[model samples]
Target: MSASSPTVPETDPVASGRPFGAVDVTWLALLGLTLLTWIVGDDAALGLGRSALLLMGLATLKAVLIAAVFMELARRGRMLLLGLGAYLVVLWLVLWLILARG
Candidate 1:
Protein backbone atom coordinates (compact mmCIF):
# COMPACT_ATOMS: atom_id res chain seq x y z
CA MET A 1 0.00 0.00 0.00
CA SER A 2 1.21 3.51 -0.80
CA ALA A 3 2.16 5.72 2.17
CA SER A 4 -0.46 8.24 1.07
CA SER A 5 -3.21 5.61 1.23
CA PRO A 6 -5.52 5.94 4.19
CA THR A 7 -4.55 3.52 6.91
CA VAL A 8 -6.99 2.36 9.52
CA PRO A 9 -5.14 2.36 12.83
CA GLU A 10 -6.00 0.01 15.68
CA THR A 11 -5.83 2.72 18.30
CA ASP A 12 -8.55 3.43 20.82
CA PRO A 13 -11.24 5.92 19.86
CA VAL A 14 -10.16 8.29 22.66
CA ALA A 15 -6.72 8.46 21.06
CA SER A 16 -8.12 8.82 17.56
CA GLY A 17 -9.49 12.20 16.44
CA ARG A 18 -12.90 10.72 15.57
CA PRO A 19 -15.61 11.08 18.20
CA PHE A 20 -17.28 8.00 19.68
CA GLY A 21 -19.95 6.69 17.34
CA ALA A 22 -23.46 5.67 18.29
CA VAL A 23 -22.59 2.06 17.60
CA ASP A 24 -19.80 2.17 20.17
CA VAL A 25 -22.10 3.64 22.81
CA THR A 26 -24.78 1.08 22.00
CA TRP A 27 -22.30 -1.78 22.21
CA LEU A 28 -20.97 -0.65 25.59
CA ALA A 29 -24.48 -0.18 26.92
CA LEU A 30 -25.43 -3.61 25.67
CA LEU A 31 -22.41 -5.11 27.38
CA GLY A 32 -23.38 -3.56 30.70
CA LEU A 33 -26.99 -4.60 30.25
CA THR A 34 -25.90 -8.15 29.48
CA LEU A 35 -23.89 -8.29 32.69
CA LEU A 36 -26.73 -6.84 34.72
CA THR A 37 -29.24 -9.23 33.14
CA TRP A 38 -27.07 -12.21 33.96
CA ILE A 39 -26.77 -11.12 37.58
CA VAL A 40 -30.48 -10.47 37.99
CA GLY A 41 -31.57 -13.48 36.02
CA ASP A 42 -29.36 -15.75 38.08
CA ASP A 43 -30.71 -14.54 41.40
CA ALA A 44 -32.26 -17.43 43.38
CA ALA A 45 -35.12 -15.30 44.68
CA LEU A 46 -36.73 -14.90 41.23
CA GLY A 47 -37.51 -18.62 40.74
CA LEU A 48 -36.83 -20.63 37.60
CA GLY A 49 -39.67 -19.43 35.36
CA ARG A 50 -39.27 -15.77 36.18
CA SER A 51 -35.50 -15.92 35.78
CA ALA A 52 -35.84 -17.73 32.47
CA LEU A 53 -38.30 -15.13 31.21
CA LEU A 54 -36.05 -12.30 32.26
CA LEU A 55 -33.10 -13.87 30.50
CA MET A 56 -35.18 -14.43 27.39
CA GLY A 57 -36.32 -10.81 27.39
CA LEU A 58 -32.79 -9.60 27.78
CA ALA A 59 -31.67 -11.83 24.93
CA THR A 60 -34.38 -10.34 22.73
CA LEU A 61 -33.34 -6.81 23.67
CA LYS A 62 -29.72 -7.58 22.88
CA ALA A 63 -30.71 -9.00 19.51
CA VAL A 64 -32.68 -5.86 18.69
CA LEU A 65 -29.84 -3.62 19.77
CA ILE A 66 -27.34 -5.52 17.62
CA ALA A 67 -29.65 -5.37 14.66
CA ALA A 68 -30.36 -1.67 14.98
CA VAL A 69 -26.86 -0.45 15.78
CA PHE A 70 -24.31 -2.88 14.35
CA MET A 71 -26.45 -3.87 11.41
CA GLU A 72 -27.30 -0.22 10.66
CA LEU A 73 -30.97 -1.01 10.57
CA ALA A 74 -31.79 2.27 12.26
CA ARG A 75 -30.45 4.25 9.30
CA ARG A 76 -31.84 1.90 6.74
CA GLY A 77 -35.22 2.63 5.12
CA ARG A 78 -38.37 1.90 7.08
CA MET A 79 -39.25 -1.02 4.78
CA LEU A 80 -36.04 -2.80 5.67
CA LEU A 81 -36.58 -2.28 9.35
CA LEU A 82 -40.14 -3.52 8.98
CA GLY A 83 -38.94 -6.64 7.22
CA LEU A 84 -36.45 -7.31 9.97
CA GLY A 85 -39.12 -6.76 12.59
CA ALA A 86 -41.44 -9.16 10.81
CA TYR A 87 -38.73 -11.79 10.65
CA LEU A 88 -38.00 -11.39 14.33
CA VAL A 89 -41.67 -11.66 15.18
CA VAL A 90 -41.91 -14.89 13.24
CA LEU A 91 -38.86 -16.28 14.97
CA TRP A 92 -40.22 -15.33 18.36
CA LEU A 93 -43.57 -16.90 17.60
CA VAL A 94 -41.97 -20.15 16.50
CA LEU A 95 -39.68 -20.20 19.49
CA TRP A 96 -42.57 -19.50 21.81
CA LEU A 97 -44.62 -22.29 20.30
CA ILE A 98 -41.77 -24.75 20.68
CA LEU A 99 -40.97 -23.72 24.23
CA ALA A 100 -44.63 -23.75 25.19
CA ARG A 101 -44.95 -27.34 24.07
CA GLY A 102 -42.30 -28.48 26.54
Candidate 2:
Protein backbone atom coordinates (compact mmCIF):
# COMPACT_ATOMS: atom_id res chain seq x y z
CA MET A 1 0.00 0.00 0.00
CA SER A 2 3.03 2.28 -0.31
CA ALA A 3 2.57 5.36 -2.46
CA SER A 4 5.65 4.61 -4.54
CA SER A 5 4.64 0.99 -5.31
CA PRO A 6 2.13 0.55 -8.09
CA THR A 7 -0.47 -2.20 -7.67
CA VAL A 8 -0.46 -4.74 -10.49
CA PRO A 9 -3.63 -6.08 -12.10
CA GLU A 10 -5.07 -9.45 -11.12
CA THR A 11 -4.06 -11.23 -14.28
CA ASP A 12 -2.63 -14.44 -12.95
CA PRO A 13 -3.20 -17.69 -14.92
CA VAL A 14 -6.29 -18.84 -13.04
CA ALA A 15 -7.75 -15.35 -13.01
CA SER A 16 -7.18 -15.14 -16.74
CA GLY A 17 -9.75 -17.93 -17.26
CA ARG A 18 -7.23 -20.56 -18.42
CA PRO A 19 -5.06 -22.36 -15.90
CA PHE A 20 -3.24 -24.58 -18.42
CA GLY A 21 -2.26 -22.78 -21.58
CA ALA A 22 -0.99 -23.94 -24.94
CA VAL A 23 2.57 -24.41 -23.66
CA ASP A 24 1.52 -26.73 -20.86
CA VAL A 25 -0.58 -28.85 -23.20
CA THR A 26 2.22 -28.96 -25.75
CA TRP A 27 4.71 -30.10 -23.11
CA LEU A 28 2.49 -32.94 -21.99
CA ALA A 29 1.98 -33.99 -25.61
CA LEU A 30 5.72 -33.99 -26.22
CA LEU A 31 6.31 -36.17 -23.17
CA GLY A 32 3.73 -38.68 -24.37
CA LEU A 33 5.28 -38.72 -27.83
CA THR A 34 8.72 -39.35 -26.33
CA LEU A 35 7.38 -42.30 -24.39
CA LEU A 36 5.75 -43.71 -27.51
CA THR A 37 8.99 -43.28 -29.45
CA TRP A 38 10.89 -45.24 -26.82
CA ILE A 39 8.35 -48.02 -26.87
CA VAL A 40 8.56 -48.21 -30.66
CA GLY A 41 12.35 -48.35 -30.45
CA ASP A 42 12.30 -51.25 -27.98
CA ASP A 43 9.82 -53.36 -29.90
CA ALA A 44 11.61 -56.13 -31.83
CA ALA A 45 8.75 -57.41 -33.93
CA LEU A 46 8.44 -54.50 -36.33
CA GLY A 47 10.59 -54.70 -39.44
CA LEU A 48 13.25 -52.07 -40.04
CA GLY A 49 11.22 -50.29 -42.66
CA ARG A 50 8.14 -49.96 -40.51
CA SER A 51 10.15 -48.96 -37.45
CA ALA A 52 12.09 -46.32 -39.34
CA LEU A 53 8.93 -44.88 -40.85
CA LEU A 54 7.16 -44.71 -37.49
CA LEU A 55 10.12 -43.07 -35.82
CA MET A 56 10.45 -40.55 -38.59
CA GLY A 57 6.77 -39.67 -38.37
CA LEU A 58 6.95 -39.22 -34.62
CA ALA A 59 10.04 -37.04 -34.96
CA THR A 60 8.31 -34.83 -37.48
CA LEU A 61 5.27 -34.42 -35.25
CA LYS A 62 7.49 -33.44 -32.34
CA ALA A 63 9.34 -30.98 -34.52
CA VAL A 64 6.12 -29.27 -35.57
CA LEU A 65 4.83 -29.11 -32.02
CA ILE A 66 8.06 -27.59 -30.76
CA ALA A 67 8.16 -25.04 -33.53
CA ALA A 68 4.55 -23.97 -33.19
CA VAL A 69 4.47 -23.76 -29.40
CA PHE A 70 8.03 -23.19 -28.10
CA MET A 71 9.10 -21.08 -31.01
CA GLU A 72 5.82 -19.08 -30.93
CA LEU A 73 5.35 -19.64 -34.62
CA ALA A 74 1.62 -20.10 -34.20
CA ARG A 75 1.22 -16.52 -33.01
CA ARG A 76 3.55 -14.39 -35.11
CA GLY A 77 4.97 -16.39 -37.98
CA ARG A 78 2.19 -17.62 -40.18
CA MET A 79 4.34 -17.52 -43.31
CA LEU A 80 7.18 -19.29 -41.61
CA LEU A 81 4.80 -21.93 -40.32
CA LEU A 82 3.47 -22.49 -43.78
CA GLY A 83 6.98 -22.79 -45.15
CA LEU A 84 7.92 -25.25 -42.44
CA GLY A 85 4.83 -27.33 -43.20
CA ALA A 86 5.78 -27.49 -46.85
CA TYR A 87 9.35 -28.45 -46.08
CA LEU A 88 8.26 -31.21 -43.75
CA VAL A 89 5.90 -32.60 -46.37
CA VAL A 90 8.70 -32.73 -48.90
CA LEU A 91 11.10 -34.26 -46.42
CA TRP A 92 8.66 -36.97 -45.52
CA LEU A 93 8.00 -37.71 -49.18
CA VAL A 94 11.70 -38.12 -49.90
CA LEU A 95 12.19 -40.32 -46.86
CA TRP A 96 9.26 -42.50 -47.83
CA LEU A 97 10.59 -42.84 -51.37
CA ILE A 98 14.02 -43.83 -50.15
CA LEU A 99 12.63 -46.31 -47.65
CA ALA A 100 10.28 -47.78 -50.21
CA ARG A 101 13.00 -48.27 -52.81
CA GLY A 102 15.35 -50.04 -50.45
Q: Name the top TM-score candidate.
A: 2
Model 2, 31-56: lDDT tens per residue? 99999999998998987778878887
CA lDDT of 62 in candidate 2? 91
Per-residue CA lDDT of model 1 for 1-102, tens digit only, reads: 788974554453444766777778998999998898979866989765566556666777778778887887776555777777767766766665555555
**Residue 21 lDDT (model 1):** 76
Could you tell me which residue pairs clash in candidate 1?
none
| Cα lDDT computed for each candidate against the true fold | 0.72, 0.81
In model 1, the runs with Cα more than 4 Å from the true position are 1-18, 89-102
Task: List TM-scores for all candidates, in order.
Answer: 0.63, 0.73
lDDT value for candidate 2? Answer: 0.81
Q: lDDT, candidate 1, residue 43? A: 90
